[model samples]
Target: MTGQLRAAIYARFSTDMQRDASIEDQIRSCREYAARQGLKVVETYSDRAVSGASLMRSGMQKLLRDGRSGLFDVVISEGLDRLSRNQADIAQIYQSLLFAEVMIETVSEGAISEMHIGLKGTMNALFLKDLAVKTHRGLKGRALAGKSAGGLTYGYSAVHQITPNGDPIRGDRTINNGEAAVVRRIFQDYAKGISPKKIAEALNVEGIPGPQGGEWGASTIHGNRERGTGIINNSAYIGRQIWNRLRYVKDPATGKRVSRLNPESDWVITEVPDLRIIDDALWEKVRTRQGALKSKETGVPVWDRRRPRTLFSGLMECGCCGAGFSKVQKDSFGCSAARNKGKAICTNMTTIKQKDLEARVLDALAHHLMDPEAVTAFCEAYTAERNRLASAATSTRTTLEKDLATTKRDHGKLVDAIIAGVPADQVKDKMIALDARRKELEGQLAQADSSAAPVRLHPKMSETYRERVAALIRGLADSEGMEEAREAIRGLIEKIVLTPRADGSGLTVDLHGALASLLLLATGAPVHRIARMAAGGQNDKSSAGAELQGVDMIDKSVLVAGAGFEPAAFRL
Candidate 1:
C-alpha cells in the first residue's frame, strides 16, 4: 500500500449500555493508524449502539456500498469484530471487499484476511454466546430470590438501593399505589362481567393512562391466556413471579428476534407476598370468569388461524383517526378506536354492514376500476419505460462484454506463457485473478440480459381484469376454493378507508388497490403466490406495494381514473 492510498474509517459499538464515546475512541485510533501510514482518510462511518452481529446496520451497509462503488481503496476499523461478530457476515464482507479490490486494516488485527475472518469470527461469536449464558444465569438467580428477572410489570415501580459495599442493587421492585389501585379496579370490572373492550373504553374516558403511558387498548387488557401476558394474566398481581416462560431466538434471514414459548415444567415460579396487588378472592373470581369465557370460545386460537374469515377483515381503516375498522357486531364493522378507546380518541361511530361493504368494494373493483382507456394508457407508459431501461441496460451489457473479452484474452496470454516453459508459479496468481474477473463480468451480462427482456401486455387487459374479479367474486359464493379466491382478491387491496359523510347519511368507503397486484391479477397471474415468492414464502401484505414503488412502472393518477366516487378527504 502507498502513502497516497485512500481509506474509509468504520467504527461501531454494540449496545446502549456501552458509552457513546466508544465510537469516538475507535475512530480516533483508526485515524491515528491511517495518519501513521500516510493514508488519506476519505470518509468515516459509525454505527452507535448497534450490534456487529448483523450487517444490517445502516452505517455498515453504506460503507459496503461505497466500497463497491470504488469510493475508497481501503477500510480502517478498530478490529475485525467491529465489522461483524457473525461468522457468515464477516466472511461475506471480506469477499465483497475482495471483489471490489479494497483492503481492510484494523488497529487490533493489523490487516484482515480470510484466516483472520474465520478465527476471529468464531471467537467473537463464542463471546456472545458465553455472555448470554452468564447473563441468563444471573437473572435466574434473581428470579429464584423473588426479584424481578425482566422488565418491571405494570402496577410496580423499580426500587433502587445500594448494597453494603456501595454497589447498586438490581432487579428490585415495589408496588405503585396508584397503579395497583387501577389494577384492582380492572380485576373487579372483569369479574363483574364487563368485557375487556368496555373496560378499556371506560378507562380511556376517565383519562387513565395505560401501560407505558399510552392510550388504553383492549389487547392491552385481555392478553393471550396461554402466554400469561397482558395486565389481567400477569401472576405478579397474585404474589407469584414467573420466569423463563419464553425464549427468543434471532431469525437468520431477517436478523429479528422471535419469541417461542417454553413448556410449563421449564417455567420458574416464585412467591412474593409483599408485591401482591390483588387478593385471593378477587383473583379467583377473575380467573373463573376468564375460564368461562375461554370455554365459550374453544375452537381455534386467533394466532393459530391461517387467514381471516372475512374478505375485508384487515383492510378497512377509519379515516378520522387512522385506526382500524373491525367487526363491531355480528354483521357490521365500525371504527375500533371509537368502540374500544371511546369518543376521546375517535368520534367516528358510523358502522356499515359487511354484505353492503363487500358488495360496494367488489363492484368498484370489477366495474369502476381498470377502465380500458386507463389500461391502454398504462400499457403504453410501461412499454416506453421498459424500452428506456432496456436501452440503459444495453450500454451496461456492452461494457461488461468488452471487459469480459479483455479479461479472457489476458488470461489466455498468461496460459500461453506458462505453456512456453515459463514457471507456472510466476503467472498462477495473475491468471486466477483474470479468471475471477471474467466470471464476474459474465454474471453481470447475464443479469442485464434478463432484465432487458421485453414484456408484452395482453390486448384486452381491462376485460381480463373484470373477468378475473367477477370469477373471484363468484367463487366467494361457492364453497369450493373459496378461501384461495378470497386470499387472491384480498391481496389486490391495500386498504379500504371509511369516513363519516358530512350530511350524516352514513359512512363513505374509499378503496385503495395495490397497483402491482392489480396489474398481476389483470394479467391472469396468481397475486398471492407471486407476493409470497417475493417475500421468501411468507405472506407479506406489503410486498405488492413494495414492488409497485420499486419498479415505478405505473403512474399514481391512473389508479382510479374511471371510478365515479370522489377521492377521500384524507389518505391513510
Candidate 2:
C-alpha cells in the first residue's frame, strides 16, 4: 500500500425525518476531515430516505463495493452512528474492510478509533429501534381509525383524495371507482371451492400482477382481493351481507383497541342494490359446498378427540435414532417405548425428573444471562479500562510524531556535515544511530496505536443474552397464570436432553442452546434434581420453583452489573 492515505466519506440522512438540505451539513463534515488528514476525498456517499438498518440502499452498496476494490485506504462517516442502526451489520462492514487494508474514521473521532466503534454502533441500533416503534405506532393508529395501513389491494389503487393545497382532487367530496368487479371475481373463485393457492396460480396464469405489481402471494390475494371498499367480511359471496359482524372496542384493562369477528347472531343483514355480481342462490350453494369441504378437511367438531398435553412432548428426540421422545411423565420425560424396547435398534430410554433438574437449569440461566445492572457495571468497568489504553496510545503517537520530525532534521544535518568534509565513518555511524532510533520509535507507535479491542460481548450481546436466559427460566417456571410467557420460552429452548442417573435413578438434564447453557454458569448453579409429577399430572409438591420475584427479566440488562430492575433495560 502507498504511504499516502486515501479515504471515502459516507453521509446519510432520512428524508422522512430531516430536510434534504441537511445533506450539505454532512458534505461539509467530510471536506473538513479530508483537509485535516491531507487525504483525498475520492468519493462521497449518501442515502436519502433510506434506513441505516441495512446496506440495501443502492448508493451505500456502491460505496462498499468501491472500498472492496481498494479505491481507498479508509472510509469515513460523519459518525459511526450514521453508518448503521444494526450492530451486526456494522460489524460485517468493519470486517469486510480488512480485505482492502481499509481503515474506518469518523469526524471528531479520527482514524482507527476502536473504543468509539462499539459505542456508536449501539447508539445507531437504538435509533433504529426507536424509528421502528414510531412507525408501528402510526400504522396501528391508522388501522384503528379504519384508514389504509397497507398498499392498494388487488382491485383498488391509492390516488390522492386531497391535493397538497388541501383542494378536493377527486369528486369534490370523493370518487369511488368500479373496482367492485375485480373484488367479486376473487370471492366468486373462493366460493367455487378453489383453494387460495389455486386462485394464486390462476391469477399468475392470467398474467395478473398483484397490488405491488409483482407475483401473487396467498395473503395478498386473501386480505385485499375483496369485492368492495366496504367491510371486507362482506357475505354477498355467501348470498348475504352481514352488517356489524366484526366489532371493534377498546380493551377494558389495557385500554388498547381490539377487533373480534362476532357470531352470526349479532350480524345485521342488508341487501345491496349495487350491480349484482352473482346470483344469490348460486352463491349460497357455493358457500355450503365450501363449508362442508372445510369441515371435512379440519375434522368435524364432535369427533375431535383431545390429546394429552406435555411441555416437551414430540420435541425431545433421541440423539442416536433421532425419533421424537414422548413425555412419559412430568418428572420422567423419556424416549418412546416402541423404539427403546427394540434394544440397540434405536436409542436408550433416557428419562429425567421435572422438579430439581429444572431449578439447576434456571440457576444457570440467572448467572449467564446476567442482570442488566451487572452488565452495565461490567461495561462501565470495561469502558474505563479501554479509555486508559487509548490515552496511552495517543501519548505514544504524539511522541512518535516528534521523533519522526527530529530524525528528518538529523538526516539533513548528517549529510551537510559529510559534505563539509567531516570523517566519513563518523557521519555514517551517526546516520545509523538515527535510523535505528527512528525504527524503534515507529515500532512503539504502531504497537500503541494498533487496536486493543475493549471487552466486547459481540454476538453475545446484552439484549439477546437477557432474552435467552429469561426465556429458559420462564419455560421451567411455568407458574399459574403465565401461559403466554411459558410458550414464548418454549419457542426459545428448542429442546432439553435428559440422561438417566448412573444408578438407574431419575435423569440429569443437560440443557443445550449455547447461550442458554452459558447462563447456568452466571447463576453459579450446576445440577438439578428432578421429582415425579403427581398422578393428576399437574406438578410435584414440596419442591420449590424459581421465580423472578417481580423483576421484569425482559428489561434487565444482562451486561449491567447491579440489581433492582425497574421497567426498561436501564443501568442503575
Find the candidate with the highest lDDT and give its number: 1
TM-score of each: 0.84, 0.39
Tens digit of per-residue lDDT, candidate 1, span 248-279: 88888787788899999999999999999999
lDDT by residue for model 2 over 1-572, one digit each (tens)?
65778878888886565877677798788788888888887888888887666667777788889988889888888877677767777877776774345889888667644345567777777877798679656755554443444433333444567778886443111113444555566667767766555566566666665556565534444332122222123344333333444555545343345767667675455443342355666556544653464345556421132324554444355555555555457466556532323342344666655445445555544553355655565445446656776686677577678877898799889989989999879778668767765776676667555454432433235566566556545555556525544433333333455545668765555443222222332332221311121121222211112111111122122221234322222111
lDDT of 1 at 348: 98
For all candidates in order, the CA lDDT equals 0.81, 0.53
User: Which runs in model 1 stand beyond 4 Å of their true positions?
Assistant: 1-8, 34-44, 55-76, 91-105, 110-117, 163-166, 295-308, 398-441, 458-460, 526-558, 563-572
TM-score of 1: 0.84
Q: After superposition, which runs of candidate 2 have C-alpha atoms over 4 Å from their true positions?
A: 15-29, 44-48, 57-62, 65-69, 98-100, 108-112, 159-178, 194-208, 215-572
- Candidate 1, residue 384: Cα displacement in angstroms equals 3.2
